[model samples]
Target: MPLPLHHLRAGIIGTGFIAPVHIEALKRLGVQVTAISGSTKGTQALAEQWGTPEVYGDYDYQSLINSPNVDVVHITSPNRVHVEQSLAALAAGKHVVCEKPLGMTTEETAKVVAAAAASDRVFAVNYLCRFYPAILQMRAMVQRGELGRIIHVQGHFFQDWLLKDTDYNWRVLSSEGGKLRAVGDIGTHWIDAVSFILGARAKSVFATLETFHKTRYRPTGEVQTFTSQSDPASMVPYEVDTEDFGSVLLKFGQADHGHVSGTHANCAISQVAAGWKCSLYVGIYGTKGSVQWEFQQPNEIQAGYRDQPNQVLTRNTAGFDKDVANFTDNPGGHAEGFPDGHKMHYRAVYEHIASGKSTPVLYATADDGHYEVKLCEAILRSSEKQTWVGV
Candidate 1:
């Protein structure tokens, strides 16, 4: 297991935007955050501000992994550093929770998985959405035959953050984010969710991806971003080697039966449209009725049928499903959001270590990361050759 919660000393690597999210989750779990590491001065300052002792700004990554105070490594580094850092931490005999899309590419991701499998340590990917209360409820609903037999699933995930010409990150670059940015970064989460929820593997897909904003702005003065999120006028063109919007025409084979009736069908994921803020929209069509869920609204479940009135199922209330209803910890009126999902994820991870629960089977692992990377490659191949590529 993961040394008892009281004894677990966690250290975070890379203090970018998501680092704080990890720290906050650990706080809720009552785990200690002993140290933090980053390659940037601003990140080091943020770590100090957060009261993490023994801060390491320019320290060697391997030394940080080998630190005597650390019992687990919660990796929040960039895509490129995920594998190397994870391998180092795992080799140092620390349990690891690496961020999603486990590594820069499938080859690298598999190496991390191989290392984890070779060790006795607990290794997992942080695809936190699966632990969302609503999603948990939906998984239970599908299992209980509330939806009859899943027929078709239509998923859409989009955000307007990159809609502006000035928005840029290493993610927009191919070497950093790989050949497919949208499909790799966020799309894999959707794919992992569908596989876990519907319990199906994609058989094949036909895809089309593009970089609509071919040229982006660069900072005229010293700015935070490598290119620029400001200084729109003094912008320079950066070749977008990666695609911004990824449209995958998916076909999933028979995997889970009797929950939802999808004899054989499709779903899609798009990240560069507009106005979507980290939403996981699922439309499950079944024989008797259909259920819909959007991650943004985690407290309620939408259900519809031919003979009866459509209803909204709220948590801890009469309108909810039996499986998920059992885990409701709140009464009516309190609110839960994305961070709650992370909490649920951490709870599962903790339970796996503490109680030896089999839920770890459902959590994302490095192999999923490997397959997701291969899937992205297949998507690119299918898009280029105008043919279906099998996963």
Candidate 2:
């Protein structure tokens, strides 16, 4: 009575670095990469790289969205474009899987959520880190109260690419991405990862954001950077508008604080630290003791409790909760990384479109994305106002 998965078609709107990964993951699931849309010739070429046949050089986003050939639209557009593009897909009545910070502002994020609710179309955000088998185990422990009541939560993400003066991209521009800088791009992960795991929301944040480099230079003016090698001279001069280093003191209240307090809590993110290649670390202090995990060592979850030796929970290990255990395709010790998370998320979204259903399974819904943006906004407010701000 249902159509087979291979019959479904997915259209990808951006051919940026992240888009290809989504395309490949879809291909692995046997979903047709029906259409590729991009404004740049460079991106169009990228579409062909993946063996996708259809290329709309000056792609009409709305046209591709409403086309009968496409069943789902994946939005991998840059920071400024995420909200508009996702809204377009929702307007067309197609399902959507948008990247994080679904909107530049939390208010805009609410619009996306409203759109999702009105359409009855499936919607998911690309916060797939939670889908990892290891983190899922830690979440289950918190959910079952196995770790006792959560006392405190901490998360951090670091990157050094922005620290290079010669290497410049649109990410550094305030007009392109909002002003939160390192925290907006990388710190949001810290917020999302902890919130997802503890199944708690951040209420308020006491934060400070800084831009260490007041200005940067490009030897060659008006050039886009690609290639692992960036021309030292190309950086003309750009004033930094966002914070390169940021830290936040967050308080995500317990269940008894009333949903309002727990749902709105403290969280933070930062950039400009060294040796972090998208590393996400999370520490949750619970009544009995604590639980810890990090994204770099993705497959392993470290946990500790009162008077007990710390335990290492691997994917598919005995202590894993049944809900988390269901996601492990490979047995213990066979690692799953970035692509695997994307693959799992794609598979879940595909199932949603085919079955015509919504899931509370915490695959980062539009609601989650909107909430993240709001959290980011609150972080900015707290940092700017020099006071703790409520989410």
Candidate 3:
């Protein structure tokens, strides 16, 4: 039995870039954000700005988790604190929704997984890209054997945010970010989304990671991601320890249900791609047919068959799976992008909590997030050793 939800009140523990996203998604589901806890510099400003009444500072995170007003906790803090914070929330008997890369390493993630198993709490990881309508359609096609034995998968997650040497963030430093930046940050999404769509897990990984800029300009003032500041005097040069780009060769094992066996694929992930911006392009090739979906073109999927011409499937159409159709918020021609994906993901989370049952569609859980951390560890090992590492 699943945990029953009432009121769906959330206590958010971080006020970083992703906090508003979580707030907006939860609001879409009519979930109340009862409290907000920010860094040491925290104030009532964020809470007031978001219309959440209660505000807690860094030291009072426990107060937020233990607050009776908060039925759930959203851990949106940095990666280093995820395990401790999530475990605390679970121990307090509160359901939790955590931001991605659930932990900095596999061991850290496993600790949370163990805690989640021992507790009767709803735990979710924000792999919101899985909620895309086209992604759901692709998964259904592969699941129903419409794609026929999936032989290969290919994709890349590219963004130009860190293309310039002036780009800097907490993500560029190893002390704050983990040793693998690009791979841990965006590569996890590519790996998770591809594995989810294909219904397969990576068995082995062979990879390489590159840190292009040895030093980057760190801004003395606050700067948001993907935005650049050019004042040389206001920025200081800092050495980079994490990778900016990575490529991984993946050999996928047989699915748990014995489908998609022995498939192989490759993914190229980068934060320094010159012109591409948030282009997550994925294609799955099967013996009978092939399917392609790109994040930039979120509303449609391109399908090709051995015996017929290529076809395009759009949202809200009879040709798509019923689940896919249901996920599509607008008519056939209306396009839904990243924000919609987050909303649908939150919808699934709230619905599951409300019904006390898991749905047919996938929403990333502690276990799924743990598996991704394992994959990231393998990728890091493969990159360091220059040898294939088993996942």
Candidate achieving the largest lDDT: 3
Collision count for each candidate, in order:
7, 18, 0
Q: How much lDDT does each candidate structure score?
A: 0.73, 0.74, 0.85
Instruction: Name the candidate, 2 or 3, with the larger TM-score value.
Output: 3
**TM-score of every candidate:** 0.91, 0.91, 0.95
RMSD of each: 2.9, 2.9, 2.3
Clashing pairs in 1: 149-260, 149-261, 150-260, 150-261, 150-262, 151-261, 151-262
Better of 1 and 2 by lDDT: 2
Instruction: After superposing candidate 2 on the true structure, give the runs of residues whose Cα lies further than 4 Å from its correct spot.
Output: 1-4, 218-231, 254-268
Model 3 steric clash pairs: none
Residue-by-residue lDDT tens digits, candidate 1, 1-391:
3335655678888776778888888877777888888775845786667788767777456667888998778898778788889999998998888887787667788788789889877787998877766677777667777777777777777766677777777677777667888888878777777767776667788888777878876444333322237557666766667777767777776665555332444445555567776677777777788778787787877888999999887766775645554234567567677776776676666656655545445567777777777788888999898889887
TM-score, model 3 to reference: 0.95
Off by over 4 Å in 3: 1-6, 40-43, 358-361
Q: Write the per-residue lDDT of candidate 2 for residues 315-337, one digit (tens) a residue.
A: 76677646664456777778888
The candidate scoring highest on TM-score is 3
Model 3 clashing-pair count: 0
RMSD of 2: 2.9
